[model samples]
Target: MAYNAGMTEIQPSRQVDLAIIGGGAAGVLTAINALRAAAPGQRIALFEPASAVAQGIAYATPWPEHLLNVPAGKMSGFPEQPGDFLDHLLARREAPEATLAEQYVPRLDYADYLQQRLAEAAAASAGTLQVVHDAVVSLQPQSGGHRFQQAEGANWQATQVVLACGNSMRPLPLPAGNALPPGKVVDAWDYDGVRMLAGDQDLAIIGTGLSMADCVVSLLAAGHRGRIHVLSRHALLPLPHAHGGTADFDPQPLLQLPLRARMRQLREHVRIAQAQGLPWQAVMDRIRPLGQALWRSLEEADQRRFLRHVVRYWDVHRHRIAESVHDQLMAVERSGQLQRHRARLDAVLVQDANLQVHGRGTPPFNVGALINATGVETRALGLRNPLLQQLLAEGHARPGPHGLGLDADPDSGQLHDAHGAPQPGLWLVGSLRIGTLWESLAIPELRVQAQQAARAAIA
Candidate 1:
């Protein structure tokens, strides 16, 4: 609970087994896993910039309305505790009839759950975890390990560093032509930005992706109904969830098959499931265990092909919106109160109070007030985080293929260097290693990675 103020320099410990740079979900899981894997008395540290450790973009829900996409049964922080979230909800009297199938809850509660977990780990740690709440600006490889240079300007040394810096947003290209004096274009993650809106405000949302959908919901929840328009290159919406069903996951035969053949077989199995009435999410869940194998099986060219042709579609289908939230969206769509357009934004200009944004698609666009909700900006690495840019410049870590994310080995999240060798002690977690493992953004997949990455960190 004690986080450093802004930043302060502290003497590096002479010896420590693990040092994680990110304190988001992945970092939290990594800490627990390290506690699980490391010998007692082996030192561990997690660096986080937020006021508290483990507060990532997703759980930093400012408004009470923001909720988790996954149901309680599936939302548990620990994979082994499949009903952990449900139990928590039940104990708190927040459980609905369909705890696993339909219950949706605020994200702050999960944040609190993580905080409690951290507290438990801290108490049991016996000085095992040395969590520092400071922004890590850069990393430099030292003898057998690395040195972390703080963003607020400090230093620490550790044998290992996990880059769980989650959710690096893509920056919007500066609008050409007249520019808004200020406060016209907003990012979807702008939790505090809601205060800037007034009743009866006309809002133009750029990129109708998941974040855009969430933003629209927030706007509607705020009673803003002047005329909301969504502009994007594609009007494609997220694929709906098919609820849940009991499905047996047997991975033995998959483990026996050759990589490519295994991927082909699993793809066919998923297709058959969808044909038989199993929802896409259910099929994906069944496929979770094989995700890593399937990713590694694909040749580099095939991986690129999937990214170009299928990544977005896969993401929308995989990370579903809750039924309640989706129904709310349907209401907006049916009433014509919300408009979805497929087109390229030509330009945006701000002249005093009036913000003008142009577009090119069926009907030309000129909407007022725009918000960028393009979800994860896989390509905008440098613009996404100052920490990443500085690290890339200092040669601590190199960018992955096509700037997908930090490069790493299949099992270990150890980021690679300029010559494509894994940096000695640096590791990444969750979606940050997406470039290495394509089908990663989910908790089940991430939980496994957290354990493996921690074990690999001992290297």
Candidate 2:
């Protein structure tokens, strides 16, 4: 449980076969897979400052109400072992009644499954796998390998390094030149702080995404009776999963078309499916497998166009909410306790000890608190992570396309330098591959990326 602060300053330096820079699901899976594929005595080092591995921000929540967007059946940590997650849940007897394959379980349960898998992998690997509870601040290339410097003054050299650093928080989108009052704006993740607010205090949330949904859920669960104002450019909410199982559809035709044409085709297919008594979720589920290929086929202009015009709509459909959670949100909206506004935030000023929020095409409003649920920080070079900043400053890594993530070889997950040359022994997994693989965030895609990166790193 020792983090960067309490770690003994041994300045531990060792040469290992592989070094993974994160302990989230991606890093944990990569370590497990790499260790299984490595030579008998090969060593692996995993650096994570968190209290436990595999419980990244997404799964670290303790709330039972926060459920996984995807079903239990599709959340396996291993690409080859599709039933691993369900098996783990069954073995632990967690939620035996709702253990059906299509159930969207709590994210906390998923975190337990991941931790259990990581422990099992480590135990099976004997003494080859080592967990280092510290954050890596910089990665420097050396002869035949890379040297990593930890935040706690420890350094190590590895033949290969995997950057599984997941998404960072986006910068708060507050209006400029405004002297905000204390305790007015808070991060969506600060659940405790948010819970301390008065029940009848008016609140304004900055985004209309999953995080925003979670905030609303938390407030409602805490019996908050205040009016919750959700503001965004489009005010689009996530769609819910279908009641029954998902049906299959072919995405090959859509993949062959241009971005706009593909979108039109998808809309037509959804319309056809709805007319035939099938849910639109079924159609989107069919395209999940072809997401990466379809994204790669788009021209840069088309990609930008997709981001500008299609991202919000696509996100609402692609990343859905659990049926129960969706129902709760709907109930709140129906009760008039929740209000949605489609206006761009212009400024936030403090007036009479309350936050006065101004949005384009809308009248100014006052709120007791503001919450930022703007989602992940997509711009790579602007991230607050010291390691990434150091890598970019030292010319070891470059920003990915459209400022999505770090630049890496799409096929191999190998990190690239500022000169656009692929660096040996450096890899990226998970959301860091957002630019290369558009569908890299979720477990289904990340498991494949972890397997691919592990194979290349250990080869």
Candidate 3:
């Protein structure tokens, strides 16, 4: 297989057997599976605007301080080969601190592992796989398949298309016409910008989620000694993972209760597990696998209520960080370097040389830089992806539950059109399935979806 480094203007008009869009972890995994399962002469195209594949927003961070939230053992790219990621780390002698299965490795090393896996998959496959460096702007349904129009280079058709673009960052929540002060407010997604701030300049991070935790770690790693003000509605930070343990709790019974009752029952289970000398994380781990099933069992109204009131608490307990990171955050808090506020940011005032972050019931605090760590935009209505915009505009696709993502068949990831019809040869994977599957963004779910979508496309 030959990988094209750049897009070319002139090319023969040939439709590919399969086209996997996005080039991130999801797309790369799908391409790998497709390449292995495709016929001898089948051709697959993996489109990524980036120079390389597998370095999506999540894994593109260059800082070693940014570690994978999950353990190395559970971060494998292939489901059948459960130890592939851990094996890769050992083979390259890149396992830092510890060589055990539960070691938390740097996300940069994970990106390298993904790239290597992609290369090996392409090399060993009987089918031809070519990576096209281009952004797909528009995808229109055609007679036999779909036609993809790229921002650069020649447009082409594909027998099947897999939309694997990851989630987009939500815009800063500010009042209409309230523009952010230029250069003073940096998004957390811009790793370089966040890490390059002046060491002594006080900063304010907008959220208290994992992204905020990451920003704090990055700044501390960069030798920053400024006051970091973290603000959120709940003022909650992600909990730390347990050292190592398992809880034999069954989550099926909770599904039979109402949303609030389920939550109550879940808390009871956690209490029981704690009484039995098990960490709360162990109970959460047991429930993690059944998250989607439990989510789908709730009525839409109950689901909305859960989102509005219970999501923050659930997130802090469910998506935990490594014990080391959690400890660092605690040290900073105790040293008066990190301050947490339970409030919402209502406005930002440009005062002299600093930004004044204001929220109801809280006094305005001045900071040299403000970081937007509000997290990904789950709602699909105002998405900035051109292809997604076009799809919704033309009624080619509809939003998923609670308008979080594009609607698709939960089993095969086959996308459904506006009329509730499943579009042939069209599939979706990754965070885009959040509305349909609550546990869609993690590697375990992504690898499974990628494999299933690939097999279905090939079949």
By lDDT, the best candidate is: 3
Model 1 segments beyond 4 Å from truth?
A: 1-17, 36-41, 94-102, 173-179, 244-282, 362-368, 380-383
Ranking by lDDT: 3, 2, 1
Candidate 3 wrongly placed segments (more than 4 Å):
1-14, 94-99
Candidate 2, residues 68-105, lDDT tens digits: the string is: 88888888888788888888778766565355578888
lDDT of 3 by residue, 108-139 (tens): 88778888877777778887777778889889
**Candidate 2 wrong stretches, greater than 4 Å:** 1-13, 94-99, 244-248
Candidate 2 minimal-lDDT segment of 10 residues: 1-10
lDDT for 255 in candidate 1 is: 56
Q: Give per-model TM-scores.
A: 0.86, 0.94, 0.95
> Model 1, range 191-215, lDDT digits (tens) per residue?
6674356357667777777787778
What lDDT would each prediction earn against the true structure?
0.70, 0.83, 0.86
Model 2, residue pairs in steric clash? none
TM-score of candidate 3 versus the correct structure, residues matched by position: 0.95
